[model samples]
Target: MSLSLLTPLGHSNVAELIARRTLTAVFQPIVNFDGGTILGYEGLIRGPAGSALEAPGALFAQAAREGLSVALEHAAARTCVAAFASLGCEGKLFLNFSAEALVALGETRDRTVAWLNEHGLGVDRVVLELTEQCQIADVARFVTAVGALRESGIQFALDDYGTANASMNLWVRLQPDVVKIDRFFIDDIANDPLKFEAVRAMQHFAGASGARLVAEGIENAADLIVVRDMGIALGQGFFIGRPDARASREFAQGAREALDAGHIAVFPGATRTPVAASPSGGMAAAKMIVAAPAVPKSATNNDVLELFNRLPNLHAVAVVEHERPLALINRRSFMDRYALPYHRELFGKRPCMLFANASPVIIEKSMTVEQMAKLLASDDQRYLADGFVITDEERYVGLGTGESLVRAVTEVRIEAARYANPLTFLPGNIPISSHIARLVEHRAEFYACYVDLNHFKPFNDRYGYWQGDEVLKFAAAVLADVCDPTRDFLGHVGGDDFLVLFQSDDWLERAMRALRAVDTGALRFYADEDRAAGGIHGEDRRGNPAFFSFVTMAIGCVRVSPDTRGGLPYGSEEIASVAALAKHRAKQEASGFFVIDLDEGAAQLHLHEAPGAAMPQRASALS
Candidate 1:
């Protein structure tokens, strides 16, 4: 409700309300995902009924204008505590307070403790949520007050984090025990990659700071499941339990069932192609749909012919029954059959099913164009000529042609390839980062291999870039050949740098095989004399003659195990840095292969020789 819609009630109304202490408190349950149980209740305040200030927005606005915000909060706190104690609600009671009000609460600490004792509530059960409504002008004073309050067994929570005033600086200064993520980032997080990443970053920060995270405004089961699987501590929204006069003791049946489900929700992966104009993955089948007329299954061939005649550009007409598509009749084929000798009179009046293809391809409007591309290779070529029926929940909506599907699929590929290395046609940095994120979300053990060419610049100067390009392609091909198609991903991080996320158990063997291939094949790119001499003379950076050897491969591997995560969330950027650091060490080794046991909290380095398993060479150089 808009505060502007309320009448201008002077300080008299606010003073009267505070004197009567008539504010009502409603409690919303916050669920802890670990046990699928309520962790606490956030007490929300309401104004008097049938009045202009009944809505909280209007009530707060009036209080702020009348300069009675602190007084009003004190009254609201008392009402909430009294109601919560009387209703016998379990867990902590979270009371919202602005910075100014919190300072006042600290000053009245003894009186507040006495009142809580009288109401059968303990000071330890109260968590004060610092709201963003008021600003903190005195950092030192506010911090001191917050510290004093916590000394009395009170907990502080940074509310609406990511919005005004609830920033990282404040969080650090206050060292809040809890941080409630703003609803803006929580809503639709299952489908929005940006929001998902934002929340993930916040989760990482919380982990490092020893602060628990509560995702707010999770209004659907998909979002709830996503928040739960992402390892967020607590969840709160209308779907969990709406704010009511009587606090809920348990979850509703649907929410309980969802929380108890065994499987994790499949979060929508980040689209390979980032299209600014379209946020719906830019490949929905609906985008390529052609609004065409449909004919009932009982309609005669004559009726189909009439539609074709009236709309000469029509390619095919869908045969539907009760709005469900059953078949499609091609325009050209029907016309040709009608043109045959006496065929028009014989079959034109018969059911359109006589000329219809009963096994027409049906696609849902929500299917991605990439999914529809598979039909092009299917054995049935009928879709090419007769087109396909588009539906929403099995009901006919429109039709799509093979031409449009092909075009959309081609566009998606072209856009996606925009991020690929032009020379090697391998995925570039964006996709590499995306894949790392996916692996982290899966919470499974995997190996990250960072591949780079040793001394490539000197080779490029002597052999020219044409040969350099060939060498890069050769490296790509070697990596691709050894990768398990279903378990591994290969990406080129520009120039001679590449990243391989290996899920295969024989990742060590595969890395060794690639190294051997490079050791043997890389020499071919050099001239016969250079190959014989095992080196080439090139100008050094100081204009001095230097001997540059042929380019060799360096492989750095990091074992990312969930068990060793230490309950600390790892972002893709941080993981990539670890892999890169390992690669830097690999470049220092004689064998050009270094393995880091990140899972053991020890960056142990291992070196492997061809045709043998990895053997420990030395301790990790990393600190």
Candidate 2:
């Protein structure tokens, strides 16, 4: 309810409600990001049913206006503690209170403690949330009071951080036990770098201050991964659980799957070159929607005509029934039909569905540009002319033109190609990293093969960079041919280096096949004399003469599985590092292939415990 709707006469109602003790409390669970468990519930208040002050916002607003904020907060605290105790909730109980309410609680400490004991809520299990709504005029006095409360085992949290009056100075002075990041910074943090950085900075601050960070408003899997990866311990949001009189004891299935899926979120990166025109993040359809006026299914053709006449630039009109879209009437088609002889007089009063395509394409606002592109390929191409209706949960919101969908899809396609290697047209570094991250996220069983050229520098020196490019192309083709495109990803990690994430069960055979192909193809790139001698003489980097063998491929394979044996989960960067080590080991072998089975503890032994002796560096293929 709006404050403008409240009157001085409502003062008596507020007093009467408080005197009768009619306040109720609901709880929303706070989840632990790392463990994927409920850490606690934040207690929230609601007023009497069907009243002007039914919402906490309106209730608190009225209380503040009447100078009864402290009294109301105290009564609300009692209600929340009683409700939580009655429900037999576990873990900590967070109760929100303004600075004034906190100071007042400190004055009545003994009485409040006794009151909480009566409701079976210990001071140890209660965490008072101090919002930055009002400034603490007396810092020293407030600190002393908070210190006394802390002595009584009452923890404190700073709410709605990173906005308004929640300043650095206040943080240092109060030194809260928990800091709740405001929704402004937490929303869409996965896509927005600025918000991500802000939360990261807060995470670091919390670490140093010995305080825990709670990311507020985490409503999606992408954002959840970003926050969880950032190491924030606690999260609260509608996606996690909505406020309820009896909140869920466990997380939702979607939240549980996302947290346990082991897939690392694919972070969006800025594309620098024209090779990739845009970033890889999905753009929601809502971004391009036009808020076109829609007509109900009951509307007549003349009504739609009037709407079209009123808005000269309107493309199409959506026919909705009970907020659900039924069809789309293209403006041109409708106008053309009305232009026929005596058509206006004959059918102008008829139902608009006469000209509407009943099978109009309707997409949710959350649909991505890439998803919409797939729809454009469908046999029914009328969406191009009729324009698709945008909806939220199947309820019509607006209209989106085919032109915008094509433009967005084109940009996304360009972005996907941005990381392609110019020499071989294979995916480049970013794509390689993204694919590896995806594999790790899905917990897929795959072999990460790091393919590099052995003794490549001598070939480049003898045959020149042009021939070196040919050798790289040949290697890329061999690897590509060995991969099952439907189950594998091949990427060119610059120069002569390639990475293949093979999901095919016969990855061993494929690796060996590529190696054998490289062995046969290596001779063709060499000079007649070098091919005959099986080697070439070149000056080493130390100025010493050396006999370098003909360029051959080295495949370092590391098997990553869902059942990895380690203290920590495998990350994309860690997998890359492990693969590089395996590649170095492969260079030492004549077979040109080496495998590190993580299940056999070979990775830990080689990468961590052992740290094997130094190996010789291969010559740069680019040089």
**How accurate locally is residue 86 in candidate 2, as Cα lDDT from 0 to 100?**
95
Question: For model 1, how does the per-residue alpha-carbon lDDT over 52-156 read when each residue is reduced to its tens digit?
Answer: 988889998888788777777777787888899999988999999989888777766777777788888988899999997748978777877788889989898
Candidate 2 residues 1-623, lDDT tens each?
01111123344656667767788899999999777889999998899989989999999898877877767777777778888999999999998887877876776677777777877888899999988694887777788878878888889999999887887777898899999999998898777644665676788888899999888887987777767766688999988888999966987777777676544443323211222213442445888899999999999999999999999999999999999999999999999989999999999999989888998888999776656778768998887777899998899899999888887877776765657676777777666776777666657678888899987877888789998899998998899899765457777778788888887778899999999999888898777878899799997878799998888899988889878865446767667767776787898888888888754434443445444655334322111
RMSD of 1: 17.8
Error of 1 at 137 (Å): 2.4
lDDT top scorer? 1
TM-score for predicted model 1 compared with the true structure:
0.47
Off by over 4 Å in 1: 1-11, 274-623
